[model samples]
Target chain A: DQQVKQNSPSLSVQEGRISILNCDYTNSMFDYFLWYKKYPAEGPTFLISISSIKDKNEDGRFTVFLNKSAKHLSLHIVPSQPGDSAVYFCAAVITGGGNKLTFGTGTQLKVEL
Target chain B: DAGITQSPRHKVTETGTPVTLRCHQTENHRYMYWYRQDPGHGLRLIHYSYGVKDTDKGEVSDGYSVSRSKTEDFLLTLESATSSQTSVYFCAIRSGTGNSPLHFGNGTRLTVT
Candidate 1:
Protein backbone atom coordinates (compact mmCIF):
# COMPACT_ATOMS: atom_id res chain seq x y z
CA ASP A 1 0.00 0.00 0.00
CA GLN A 2 1.28 3.44 -0.89
CA GLN A 3 1.31 5.82 2.01
CA VAL A 4 1.71 8.77 -0.32
CA LYS A 5 0.20 8.88 -3.79
CA GLN A 6 0.56 11.27 -6.73
CA ASN A 7 -2.34 10.11 -8.84
CA SER A 8 -1.39 11.95 -12.01
CA PRO A 9 1.72 10.67 -13.70
CA SER A 10 2.31 13.86 -15.68
CA LEU A 11 1.07 17.37 -16.33
CA SER A 12 1.66 19.63 -19.30
CA VAL A 13 1.22 23.36 -19.38
CA GLN A 14 2.10 26.40 -21.50
CA GLU A 15 4.38 29.23 -20.59
CA GLY A 16 2.92 31.86 -18.29
CA ARG A 17 0.19 29.44 -17.36
CA ILE A 18 -0.37 27.64 -14.10
CA SER A 19 0.63 24.11 -13.15
CA ILE A 20 -0.92 22.25 -10.31
CA LEU A 21 0.14 18.85 -8.95
CA ASN A 22 -1.89 16.88 -6.49
CA CYS A 23 -1.06 14.37 -3.75
CA ASP A 24 -2.96 12.25 -1.26
CA TYR A 25 -1.93 10.42 1.87
CA THR A 26 -3.59 7.74 3.93
CA ASN A 27 -1.58 7.97 7.15
CA SER A 28 -2.86 10.17 9.90
CA MET A 29 0.49 9.94 11.62
CA PHE A 30 1.97 12.14 8.93
CA ASP A 31 2.16 15.71 10.16
CA TYR A 32 4.62 17.17 7.70
CA PHE A 33 4.47 17.30 3.94
CA LEU A 34 7.08 18.32 1.36
CA TRP A 35 7.61 18.72 -2.35
CA TYR A 36 10.70 18.06 -4.41
CA LYS A 37 11.64 18.63 -8.03
CA LYS A 38 13.95 16.44 -10.10
CA TYR A 39 15.64 16.68 -13.46
CA PRO A 40 16.94 13.82 -15.49
CA ALA A 41 20.09 12.26 -13.99
CA GLU A 42 19.87 14.47 -10.92
CA GLY A 43 18.62 13.92 -7.41
CA PRO A 44 15.54 15.63 -6.07
CA THR A 45 15.77 19.24 -4.91
CA PHE A 46 13.67 20.62 -2.12
CA LEU A 47 10.79 22.80 -3.24
CA ILE A 48 8.05 24.02 -0.93
CA SER A 49 6.54 22.49 2.18
CA ILE A 50 3.53 22.93 4.41
CA SER A 51 2.88 21.69 7.89
CA SER A 52 -0.34 20.13 9.05
CA ILE A 53 -0.70 23.01 11.48
CA LYS A 54 -1.36 25.38 8.62
CA ASP A 55 -3.55 25.11 5.56
CA LYS A 56 -1.24 26.79 3.08
CA ASN A 57 2.33 27.98 2.45
CA GLU A 58 3.79 29.98 -0.35
CA ASP A 59 7.21 30.62 -1.78
CA GLY A 60 7.35 33.00 -4.71
CA ARG A 61 5.32 31.46 -7.53
CA PHE A 62 4.95 28.18 -5.71
CA THR A 63 2.17 27.67 -3.21
CA VAL A 64 1.25 24.49 -1.37
CA PHE A 65 -2.17 24.00 0.10
CA LEU A 66 -2.87 21.28 2.60
CA ASN A 67 -6.31 20.03 3.59
CA LYS A 68 -5.85 18.00 6.74
CA SER A 69 -9.44 16.83 6.86
CA ALA A 70 -9.14 15.44 3.37
CA LYS A 71 -5.62 14.04 3.76
CA HIS A 72 -4.61 15.87 0.62
CA LEU A 73 -2.26 18.59 -0.63
CA SER A 74 -1.65 20.41 -3.87
CA LEU A 75 1.19 22.46 -5.34
CA HIS A 76 0.55 25.36 -7.64
CA ILE A 77 3.14 27.20 -9.71
CA VAL A 78 1.85 30.28 -11.43
CA PRO A 79 3.28 31.66 -14.64
CA SER A 80 5.16 28.46 -15.24
CA GLN A 81 8.30 28.53 -17.34
CA PRO A 82 10.13 26.05 -19.47
CA GLY A 83 12.72 25.64 -16.76
CA ASP A 84 9.98 24.28 -14.54
CA SER A 85 9.78 21.14 -16.60
CA ALA A 86 10.70 18.18 -14.37
CA VAL A 87 9.36 15.45 -12.19
CA TYR A 88 7.75 16.54 -8.94
CA PHE A 89 7.40 14.34 -5.88
CA CYS A 90 5.21 14.66 -2.84
CA ALA A 91 6.55 13.25 0.42
CA ALA A 92 5.34 12.93 3.97
CA VAL A 93 6.73 12.07 7.38
CA ILE A 94 5.55 11.56 10.89
CA THR A 95 6.49 14.08 13.51
CA GLY A 96 9.64 13.27 15.51
CA GLY A 97 10.12 10.00 13.59
CA GLY A 98 13.81 10.46 12.88
CA ASN A 99 12.83 12.25 9.69
CA LYS A 100 11.97 9.13 7.72
CA LEU A 101 10.07 10.35 4.65
CA THR A 102 7.81 8.40 2.30
CA PHE A 103 7.50 9.70 -1.25
CA GLY A 104 4.94 9.46 -4.03
CA THR A 105 5.59 7.98 -7.45
CA GLY A 106 6.11 11.51 -8.92
CA THR A 107 4.44 13.61 -11.61
CA GLN A 108 6.34 14.81 -14.65
CA LEU A 109 5.40 18.39 -15.50
CA LYS A 110 6.27 19.73 -18.91
CA VAL A 111 6.15 23.47 -19.48
CA GLU A 112 5.93 24.27 -23.15
CA LEU A 113 7.09 27.39 -24.90
CA ASP B 1 22.70 22.70 0.14
CA ALA B 2 23.80 20.45 3.01
CA GLY B 3 27.16 19.57 1.47
CA ILE B 4 26.19 16.05 0.47
CA THR B 5 28.18 13.87 -1.91
CA GLN B 6 27.55 10.43 -3.41
CA SER B 7 30.39 8.41 -4.86
CA PRO B 8 30.63 6.42 -8.10
CA ARG B 9 28.09 8.47 -10.06
CA HIS B 10 27.39 5.35 -12.11
CA LYS B 11 28.12 1.65 -11.82
CA VAL B 12 27.24 -1.55 -13.62
CA THR B 13 27.78 -4.99 -12.11
CA GLU B 14 26.64 -8.54 -12.63
CA THR B 15 24.12 -10.31 -10.47
CA GLY B 16 25.39 -11.80 -7.20
CA THR B 17 28.22 -9.24 -7.00
CA PRO B 18 28.46 -7.08 -3.95
CA VAL B 19 28.08 -3.35 -4.49
CA THR B 20 28.21 -0.42 -2.16
CA LEU B 21 27.20 3.22 -2.51
CA ARG B 22 28.75 5.84 -0.30
CA CYS B 23 27.27 9.11 0.98
CA HIS B 24 29.45 11.73 2.59
CA GLN B 25 28.32 14.92 4.24
CA THR B 26 30.49 17.86 5.10
CA GLU B 27 27.90 19.36 7.38
CA ASN B 28 28.13 16.43 9.82
CA HIS B 29 24.37 16.42 10.06
CA ARG B 30 23.02 13.86 12.52
CA TYR B 31 20.41 12.54 10.11
CA MET B 32 21.51 10.66 7.01
CA TYR B 33 19.29 8.62 4.74
CA TRP B 34 19.44 6.37 1.71
CA TYR B 35 16.73 6.30 -0.93
CA ARG B 36 16.33 4.69 -4.34
CA GLN B 37 14.47 6.23 -7.30
CA ASP B 38 12.96 4.22 -10.09
CA PRO B 39 10.16 4.40 -12.60
CA GLY B 40 6.81 4.17 -10.81
CA HIS B 41 8.70 4.62 -7.56
CA GLY B 42 9.66 8.13 -6.62
CA LEU B 43 12.09 7.69 -3.80
CA ARG B 44 11.94 4.67 -1.51
CA LEU B 45 13.90 4.75 1.70
CA ILE B 46 16.32 1.89 2.20
CA HIS B 47 17.87 2.80 5.55
CA TYR B 48 18.97 5.73 7.65
CA SER B 49 21.43 6.78 10.35
CA TYR B 50 20.83 9.23 13.12
CA GLY B 51 24.40 9.15 14.33
CA VAL B 52 27.52 7.05 14.26
CA LYS B 53 26.62 3.44 15.13
CA ASP B 54 22.96 4.45 15.38
CA THR B 55 21.07 3.20 12.36
CA ASP B 56 17.54 2.14 11.57
CA LYS B 57 15.70 0.48 8.74
CA GLY B 58 13.41 2.38 6.38
CA GLU B 59 10.46 1.07 4.41
CA VAL B 60 12.54 -0.78 1.84
CA SER B 61 15.50 -2.10 3.80
CA ASP B 62 15.34 -5.61 2.45
CA GLY B 63 18.53 -6.88 0.77
CA TYR B 64 20.41 -3.75 1.85
CA SER B 65 22.60 -2.88 4.79
CA VAL B 66 23.92 0.45 5.98
CA SER B 67 26.79 1.39 8.27
CA ARG B 68 27.68 4.73 9.77
CA SER B 69 31.05 4.36 11.43
CA LYS B 70 31.51 8.12 11.53
CA THR B 71 29.34 11.20 11.51
CA GLU B 72 30.18 12.23 7.99
CA ASP B 73 29.81 9.00 6.05
CA PHE B 74 27.04 6.47 5.43
CA LEU B 75 27.59 3.35 3.40
CA LEU B 76 24.90 1.21 1.79
CA THR B 77 25.92 -2.24 0.69
CA LEU B 78 23.93 -4.60 -1.42
CA GLU B 79 25.08 -8.06 -0.35
CA SER B 80 24.27 -9.50 -3.77
CA ALA B 81 23.21 -7.43 -6.71
CA THR B 82 20.08 -8.27 -8.66
CA SER B 83 18.37 -6.84 -11.71
CA SER B 84 15.61 -5.69 -9.45
CA GLN B 85 18.11 -3.48 -7.62
CA THR B 86 18.99 -1.42 -10.66
CA SER B 87 18.08 2.22 -10.00
CA VAL B 88 19.42 5.59 -8.97
CA TYR B 89 20.46 5.83 -5.34
CA PHE B 90 20.37 9.10 -3.44
CA CYS B 91 21.78 10.17 -0.12
CA ALA B 92 20.05 12.77 1.95
CA ILE B 93 20.63 14.86 5.06
CA ARG B 94 17.88 16.24 7.21
CA SER B 95 18.06 19.33 9.44
CA GLY B 96 17.10 17.24 12.51
CA THR B 97 14.06 19.40 13.07
CA GLY B 98 10.58 17.94 13.16
CA ASN B 99 9.50 19.44 9.85
CA SER B 100 12.70 20.46 8.09
CA PRO B 101 13.31 19.67 4.47
CA LEU B 102 15.99 17.21 3.29
CA HIS B 103 18.96 18.03 1.10
CA PHE B 104 20.16 15.47 -1.43
CA GLY B 105 23.22 14.57 -3.44
CA ASN B 106 23.55 14.21 -7.20
CA GLY B 107 22.79 10.47 -6.93
CA THR B 108 24.48 7.29 -8.10
CA ARG B 109 23.04 5.28 -10.95
CA LEU B 110 23.54 1.58 -10.40
CA THR B 111 22.67 -1.18 -12.83
CA VAL B 112 22.70 -4.82 -11.86
CA THR B 113 22.48 -7.18 -14.78
Candidate 2:
Protein backbone atom coordinates (compact mmCIF):
# COMPACT_ATOMS: atom_id res chain seq x y z
CA ASP A 1 0.00 0.00 0.00
CA GLN A 2 1.12 3.51 -0.69
CA GLN A 3 1.52 5.35 2.57
CA VAL A 4 1.86 8.67 0.83
CA LYS A 5 -0.04 9.82 -2.27
CA GLN A 6 0.25 12.74 -4.67
CA ASN A 7 -3.01 12.74 -6.59
CA SER A 8 -1.91 15.07 -9.37
CA PRO A 9 0.56 13.66 -11.86
CA SER A 10 1.30 17.06 -13.39
CA LEU A 11 0.69 20.75 -12.92
CA SER A 12 1.24 23.90 -14.93
CA VAL A 13 1.42 27.46 -13.75
CA GLN A 14 2.33 30.81 -15.19
CA GLU A 15 5.45 32.57 -14.05
CA GLY A 16 4.89 34.92 -11.09
CA ARG A 17 1.83 32.94 -10.06
CA ILE A 18 1.44 30.69 -7.08
CA SER A 19 1.89 26.93 -7.53
CA ILE A 20 0.38 24.58 -5.05
CA LEU A 21 1.15 20.85 -4.82
CA ASN A 22 -0.82 18.62 -2.55
CA CYS A 23 -0.06 15.34 -0.78
CA ASP A 24 -1.78 12.96 1.57
CA TYR A 25 -0.62 10.22 3.88
CA THR A 26 -2.35 7.23 5.37
CA ASN A 27 0.06 6.64 8.19
CA SER A 28 -0.65 8.39 11.41
CA MET A 29 2.76 7.63 12.82
CA PHE A 30 4.37 10.02 10.40
CA ASP A 31 5.39 13.10 12.32
CA TYR A 32 7.67 14.90 9.91
CA PHE A 33 6.94 15.88 6.32
CA LEU A 34 9.36 17.14 3.67
CA TRP A 35 9.26 18.37 0.08
CA TYR A 36 12.00 17.73 -2.45
CA LYS A 37 12.57 19.21 -5.89
CA LYS A 38 14.22 17.16 -8.62
CA TYR A 39 15.45 18.11 -12.03
CA PRO A 40 15.99 15.77 -14.94
CA ALA A 41 18.72 13.18 -14.26
CA GLU A 42 19.40 14.75 -10.84
CA GLY A 43 18.62 13.78 -7.32
CA PRO A 44 15.84 15.23 -5.29
CA THR A 45 16.91 18.26 -3.30
CA PHE A 46 15.49 19.06 0.06
CA LEU A 47 13.18 22.04 -0.05
CA ILE A 48 10.98 22.76 2.96
CA SER A 49 9.67 20.67 5.81
CA ILE A 50 7.00 20.89 8.46
CA SER A 51 6.77 19.07 11.75
CA SER A 52 3.49 17.68 12.97
CA ILE A 53 3.64 20.05 15.88
CA LYS A 54 3.46 23.05 13.58
CA ASP A 55 0.87 23.87 10.95
CA LYS A 56 3.22 25.60 8.56
CA ASN A 57 6.84 26.28 7.67
CA GLU A 58 8.29 28.75 5.22
CA ASP A 59 11.57 29.06 3.41
CA GLY A 60 12.18 31.85 0.99
CA ARG A 61 9.69 31.43 -1.89
CA PHE A 62 8.47 28.06 -0.67
CA THR A 63 5.93 27.41 2.06
CA VAL A 64 4.57 24.09 3.39
CA PHE A 65 1.39 23.73 5.32
CA LEU A 66 0.38 20.65 7.28
CA ASN A 67 -3.05 19.63 8.46
CA LYS A 68 -2.42 16.78 10.83
CA SER A 69 -6.04 16.16 11.46
CA ALA A 70 -6.64 15.60 7.78
CA LYS A 71 -3.42 13.72 7.22
CA HIS A 72 -2.63 16.11 4.40
CA LEU A 73 0.01 18.67 3.46
CA SER A 74 0.65 21.12 0.67
CA LEU A 75 3.60 22.99 -0.74
CA HIS A 76 3.18 26.47 -2.14
CA ILE A 77 5.67 28.36 -4.25
CA VAL A 78 4.88 32.00 -4.83
CA PRO A 79 6.04 33.94 -7.86
CA SER A 80 7.03 30.74 -9.54
CA GLN A 81 9.96 31.01 -11.85
CA PRO A 82 10.90 28.98 -14.88
CA GLY A 83 13.68 27.46 -12.86
CA ASP A 84 11.08 25.98 -10.57
CA SER A 85 9.92 23.59 -13.27
CA ALA A 86 10.70 20.06 -12.13
CA VAL A 87 9.35 17.05 -10.34
CA TYR A 88 8.31 17.69 -6.75
CA PHE A 89 8.10 14.82 -4.27
CA CYS A 90 6.46 14.78 -0.90
CA ALA A 91 7.94 12.51 1.75
CA ALA A 92 7.05 11.61 5.30
CA VAL A 93 8.93 10.10 8.22
CA ILE A 94 7.89 8.77 11.55
CA THR A 95 9.61 10.21 14.59
CA GLY A 96 12.06 7.78 16.23
CA GLY A 97 11.55 5.28 13.42
CA GLY A 98 15.13 5.10 12.22
CA ASN A 99 14.49 8.02 9.89
CA LYS A 100 13.01 5.93 7.11
CA LEU A 101 11.11 8.06 4.59
CA THR A 102 7.94 7.24 2.64
CA PHE A 103 7.52 9.24 -0.54
CA GLY A 104 4.62 10.08 -2.79
CA THR A 105 4.60 9.33 -6.53
CA GLY A 106 5.47 12.99 -7.38
CA THR A 107 3.99 15.88 -9.28
CA GLN A 108 5.63 17.31 -12.36
CA LEU A 109 5.45 21.11 -12.13
CA LYS A 110 5.90 23.23 -15.19
CA VAL A 111 6.33 26.96 -14.75
CA GLU A 112 5.52 28.63 -18.02
CA LEU A 113 6.67 32.04 -19.20
CA ASP B 1 24.77 20.19 -2.36
CA ALA B 2 25.40 17.23 -0.08
CA GLY B 3 28.58 15.31 -0.74
CA ILE B 4 26.87 12.18 -2.01
CA THR B 5 27.81 10.46 -5.26
CA GLN B 6 26.24 7.47 -6.99
CA SER B 7 28.51 5.66 -9.37
CA PRO B 8 27.51 4.13 -12.73
CA ARG B 9 24.99 6.90 -13.43
CA HIS B 10 23.53 4.58 -16.07
CA LYS B 11 23.73 0.86 -16.63
CA VAL B 12 22.14 -1.78 -18.84
CA THR B 13 22.24 -5.43 -17.88
CA GLU B 14 20.68 -8.59 -19.21
CA THR B 15 18.48 -10.95 -17.31
CA GLY B 16 20.22 -13.25 -14.86
CA THR B 17 23.18 -10.89 -14.62
CA PRO B 18 24.17 -9.39 -11.36
CA VAL B 19 24.43 -5.63 -10.99
CA THR B 20 25.82 -3.55 -8.22
CA LEU B 21 25.54 0.21 -7.73
CA ARG B 22 27.84 2.22 -5.52
CA CYS B 23 27.17 5.20 -3.34
CA HIS B 24 29.97 7.28 -1.85
CA GLN B 25 29.67 10.10 0.60
CA THR B 26 32.25 12.71 1.52
CA GLU B 27 30.14 14.19 4.30
CA ASN B 28 31.07 11.39 6.74
CA HIS B 29 27.44 10.95 7.62
CA ARG B 30 26.56 7.82 9.58
CA TYR B 31 23.36 6.96 7.74
CA MET B 32 23.09 5.78 4.13
CA TYR B 33 20.12 4.58 2.14
CA TRP B 34 19.36 3.04 -1.25
CA TYR B 35 16.04 3.77 -2.89
CA ARG B 36 14.43 2.88 -6.21
CA GLN B 37 12.11 5.20 -8.11
CA ASP B 38 9.57 3.77 -10.52
CA PRO B 39 6.71 5.12 -12.60
CA GLY B 40 3.77 4.63 -10.24
CA HIS B 41 5.84 4.16 -7.16
CA GLY B 42 7.69 7.15 -5.87
CA LEU B 43 10.91 6.44 -4.03
CA ARG B 44 10.93 3.20 -2.13
CA LEU B 45 13.74 2.24 0.16
CA ILE B 46 15.60 -0.89 -0.82
CA HIS B 47 18.12 -0.99 1.97
CA TYR B 48 19.83 1.18 4.53
CA SER B 49 22.85 1.22 6.82
CA TYR B 50 23.40 2.97 10.08
CA GLY B 51 27.02 2.09 10.77
CA VAL B 52 29.90 0.11 9.42
CA LYS B 53 28.91 -3.52 8.84
CA ASP B 54 25.36 -2.80 9.85
CA THR B 55 22.49 -2.89 7.43
CA ASP B 56 18.72 -3.33 7.38
CA LYS B 57 16.12 -4.12 4.76
CA GLY B 58 13.58 -1.50 3.77
CA GLU B 59 10.02 -1.89 2.61
CA VAL B 60 11.06 -3.07 -0.85
CA SER B 61 14.12 -5.19 -0.19
CA ASP B 62 13.03 -8.46 -1.75
CA GLY B 63 15.43 -8.96 -4.68
CA TYR B 64 18.12 -6.67 -3.35
CA SER B 65 21.03 -6.91 -0.95
CA VAL B 66 23.26 -4.24 0.54
CA SER B 67 26.63 -3.91 2.18
CA ARG B 68 28.35 -1.26 4.23
CA SER B 69 31.84 -2.24 5.17
CA LYS B 70 32.98 1.36 5.67
CA THR B 71 31.51 4.65 6.74
CA GLU B 72 31.80 6.38 3.38
CA ASP B 73 30.40 3.68 1.13
CA PHE B 74 27.17 1.77 0.74
CA LEU B 75 26.51 -0.71 -2.02
CA LEU B 76 23.32 -2.11 -3.51
CA THR B 77 23.41 -5.32 -5.43
CA LEU B 78 20.72 -6.79 -7.56
CA GLU B 79 21.07 -10.55 -7.69
CA SER B 80 20.05 -11.85 -11.12
CA ALA B 81 18.62 -8.82 -12.88
CA THR B 82 15.07 -8.91 -14.17
CA SER B 83 13.05 -6.56 -16.32
CA SER B 84 10.91 -5.74 -13.36
CA GLN B 85 13.97 -4.36 -11.64
CA THR B 86 14.62 -1.72 -14.27
CA SER B 87 14.32 1.63 -12.57
CA VAL B 88 16.27 4.62 -11.33
CA TYR B 89 18.13 4.18 -8.09
CA PHE B 90 19.08 6.90 -5.66
CA CYS B 91 21.39 7.04 -2.69
CA ALA B 92 20.78 9.29 0.25
CA ILE B 93 22.68 10.28 3.37
CA ARG B 94 21.86 11.91 6.62
CA SER B 95 23.47 12.69 9.94
CA GLY B 96 22.77 10.55 12.96
CA THR B 97 20.73 13.35 14.44
CA GLY B 98 17.01 12.72 14.55
CA ASN B 99 14.60 14.46 12.20
CA SER B 100 17.29 15.75 9.83
CA PRO B 101 16.32 15.73 6.16
CA LEU B 102 18.14 13.37 3.81
CA HIS B 103 20.47 14.54 1.07
CA PHE B 104 20.41 12.56 -2.19
CA GLY B 105 22.90 11.67 -4.86
CA ASN B 106 22.21 12.29 -8.54
CA GLY B 107 20.92 8.74 -9.27
CA THR B 108 21.67 5.60 -11.29
CA ARG B 109 19.41 4.52 -14.09
CA LEU B 110 19.47 0.75 -14.49
CA THR B 111 17.82 -1.07 -17.34
CA VAL B 112 17.40 -4.83 -17.27
CA THR B 113 16.47 -6.52 -20.50
Residue pairs clashing in model 1 are none
Give native contacts recovered, as a fraction, per prediction: 0.89, 0.91
Compose the digit string of candidate 2's lDDT tens values, residues A43-68: 99999999999999999999999999
Which candidate wins on DockQ?
2
lDDT of 1 at B47: 95
State in Å the error of residue A85, model 2. Answer: 0.4
Model 2 chain B lowest lDDT segment of ten = B93-102
Model 1: residues >4 Å from true position, as ranges?
none
The per-model DockQ list reads 0.89, 0.92
Which residue pairs show backbone clashes in model 2? none
Which TM-score values does chain B get in all models? 0.96, 0.98
Which ten residues in a row are the worst by lDDT in model 2 chain A? A93-102
* Candidate 1 local lDDT, A1-113, one digit each (tens): 89899999999999999999999999998988999999998889999988899999999999999999999999999989999999999999887868788999999999999
Over the stretch B1-113, how does candidate 2's per-residue lDDT look in tens digits? 59998999999999999999999999999999999999889999999998999899999999999999989999999989999999999999999797889999999999999
What is the Å distance of residue B32 in model 1 from its true position? 0.3
lDDT, residue A54, candidate 1:
98
Q: Give the TM-score of candidate 1.
A: 0.98
